[model samples]
Target: MTTTATPLALADVALRLRPGDHVAVATRELRRGTQVALPAADGGLVVTLPLTVPRGHKLAVRAAGAGEPVLKYGQSIGRATRDIAPGDHVHSHNLGMDDADRAYEFGTARVALPPAAVERTFRGYRRADGRWGTRNYIGIVTSVNCSASTARLIADQFRGRVLDAYPHVDGVVALTHDTGCGLVPTSDGAQVTRRTLRGYASHPNMAGLLVVGLGCEMLPVDGLLDGLALAPGTPVRRLVIQETGGIRATVRAGVAAIEEMLPAIDALRREEAPASALVLGLNCGGSDGYSGITANPALGRASDLLVAQGGTSVLAETPEVFGAEHLLLRRAVSREVGQRLLDRLDWWKGYTAAGGGTMDNNPSPGNKAGGLTTILEKSLGAVAKAGTAELVAVKEYAEPVTERGLVFMDTPGYDPVSVTGIVAGGATVVVFTTGRGSVLGCKPSPSIKVATNTETYERMREDMDLDAGRIVTGTATVEEIGEELFERVLAVASGEQTVSEELDLGSDEFVPWQLGAVT
Candidate 1:
């Protein structure tokens, strides 16, 4: 399962990421005594394998003393735990993240990309607030977990062929979550939830909205709309189960209300819009060793292209980008933006410490099996999705995205929470890259999945929208794949259905980051 195929030549046995990298990644399984030849540009060193190594695993190319830093992607991923000889497998057993810090510099490596030669456009719904949306959905937003069932019941009434006449309307989606009542109104948890709900209710993708609530909850339906701003004529309705004679009555009222609004929603039509209208959300999950090598960097290239066209691309999952924050800070447009990112990381250090954990506690079990050994390693790969665009802005979780180039949002490394914050920030289209096959979808926005390796691409063809694995197999270059992905983003923005949308898989992912104590 780890290797694509055994190579006949020693040079193809493993890949050296950078000229000075201490280790090389095994492209295929190599048995003991196999001789791996490095290219002339990489010093032309040849090492004999002392034991079998799985594909995606790393192997030392040169001898190193104990405590010496192990380098990958031209950066220190960690330190060697003990004296390591050439041809030895480099992994958790022999590496540690101790003493990984270095001098931090701000705005040193900033380089602006030239504008695209041609303008690109997509068909989208232009809202009254001057935003363009990739999809037109009618959302039933819940104020608390108490009203989740009722909201779903109401949305269920329009399931299947029920919306056959409303072709313009994508579908009715119930945005529900697990918390609403326990936390005090002023708590960070309560405020975060409220901000998320308001964002969803006002998202340009939502042509119509229905707010459903259980009257007794601390987070009431009325308060959820405090700062909401929707299209000038968008249809909206609210229902409280307790006041509307409970669940049965609320469902009937909600269904009737939506039925009345479908015609107007369906009347809205798509028009050609500039690509600058796009707000792209970037994320990665189930990552493997080829993630940075293939999909993520390709996505980063595409992000750079979008930025050239004057669009916004957001990268999230703060903890996932831990050790690599310096790379981003160096690209920050100003010291303030760089400092903002540092502040978020400092907060995370305290956040994890309070919970008796450390930043290095990532590279989850799945990540390790996929050949990632530490958070430093994972972060190095994860940041590749942002491309080389300037770090224009840094936003808090679920905060609206206002900048027009590459931006970073502070969020947990967990997929659902991270993506939820991005979508709530007004991302009309999301590009999610996965190395180990994740089928996550985000409603009110379409998710285009990119597979990192050929083996995983072939095994999970049904879920992946694009095969970035072509880069690893030598059939395509990163720029070619990046341009292809950029076109696909426009296609999806113009209403092309993604595999996740076809399977109806995004309704259960509306999880908001819950913080603070419940009182």
Candidate 2:
């Protein structure tokens, strides 16, 4: 594989990701009549473009018959819907999803890797349950939307400098969602919401929890507590707006409860913890053609490094992995783990069909503009974030990630909802990659943003934390940037604030995945 610097001269410039790849990505716009070189395998073949190719778009290196598979990264991205000539721009206009079943072989590629040569540690708070936390905060969780405002009001009371006296406490945060009531208690939506709230309440990052509820809501505080199975003497407080007379009285009572717990919460301190205590969440949004070639693979390398240190990393967004699930299945640690991933894919297929939608509906307008043509192309790129580690486990939405190394979590493509599930599943830090520049943050856990292209990185320098774009510039290799990202993770876990945290951007991004009917 060869990497090229960005803004290549329009005269003649293209990058073939792999020797067997059938298409070359245009590093710059290619105008009609411009000639570009193809892979050497074609014996010095050169193709003259018949149409203008946008920057980051793909151009066919050889003619492909209709219904033939188009290759990128040495893998099938999709099939050609119509005959594609050499130099033809390959996109949604000519490319379509391939419905052929993939042959899945469990554990065929599961190779054990040696441990890291260097021992690394970060300062973190070790919880009594044995989990470690990168942040220390008091969480106010709302059981129902009716109580959301009260929870926010209580948190607002301590937002700015009110916690200045409490040196160890991060701050008071209110985790409020839109749906909690107007649904049957036995419904899937209610159960998902309940599980999500309980996960946050018991998260290691939280020093104390205040579960607020509307007295008559379907999902009450008692039900959530029961479901979570919290042991006696858990550092939790509960309040009901209706039972406490009204919002005003409830807010006051909540404030008083937090005041009473502040001293004990602040008593917690950070200590040196091994890298095994870290759980990293991998996510990407606003992706472009460069995402797969640059940021995603670099993040994958970093994830592998963390796994080598006995830490855990999670890759999510189920819909985004639709066409590329076979790649992951081959790395599964067991037949059961591989089957579980396939099962999720089947469920999604049926779920989308029932909803009159399809997986190909992805690659939003922004994605197409950035050179991603279909869901298949996006999935192929998205899975690169998992690196080449063995797939240790597959988990449901909001389910706790107990296994170390690489794990998969079922979640939507929506960034906020996906990260929320990851955070609830016990991710202490999140790494997000983007080509179109997404400003996203997750509280309790710090987020690091990586830009896929130099242009996007330079344009959104304040929002992005790292530039994997250096890989495209040939200034750095994937492994080099991966190592740098690993070090940044440790530093952030040790209390260095990320750009997202500095912008105070996590408060509004805590949106949990809601399933089932609202009524």
Structural similarity to truth (TM-score) of each candidate? 0.97, 0.95
Model 1 per-residue lDDT tens digits across residues 1-519: 232243234346677788788888878877777766656664666666777778888888877789999899999989898998877888888988855466789999999988888989999998987898889999999999999999999999999999999999999999999999999998888989988888889998999999999999999999997657777888899999999999999999999999999999899999999998899999999999889889999999999999999999999999999999999999999999999999999999999999999999999988898889989999999999999999999999999888899999999989989999999999999999998899999998999999998889899999999999888778999999999999999999999999999999888977899998876
lDDT of 2 by residue, 1-519 (tens): 222333233225667887777788887778777766655666556666778888889988877889999989878888999999877999989998877777878889887657999889999988877788999888899888889999999999997777889988888889999988898888878877887888888887887889999999888888877756443344788998889989999999999999999998788889999998899999999999999988999999999999999999999999999989989999999999999999998899888899999878898999999999888889999999999999999999989888989999999999999999999998999999999999998988899999998999999999999999888778999999998999999999988889998887887899999888887
> lDDT per prediction?
0.90, 0.88
lDDT leader: 1
Clashes of each: 0, 0
Best by TM-score: 1
lDDT of 2: 0.88
Pairs with steric clashes in candidate 1: none
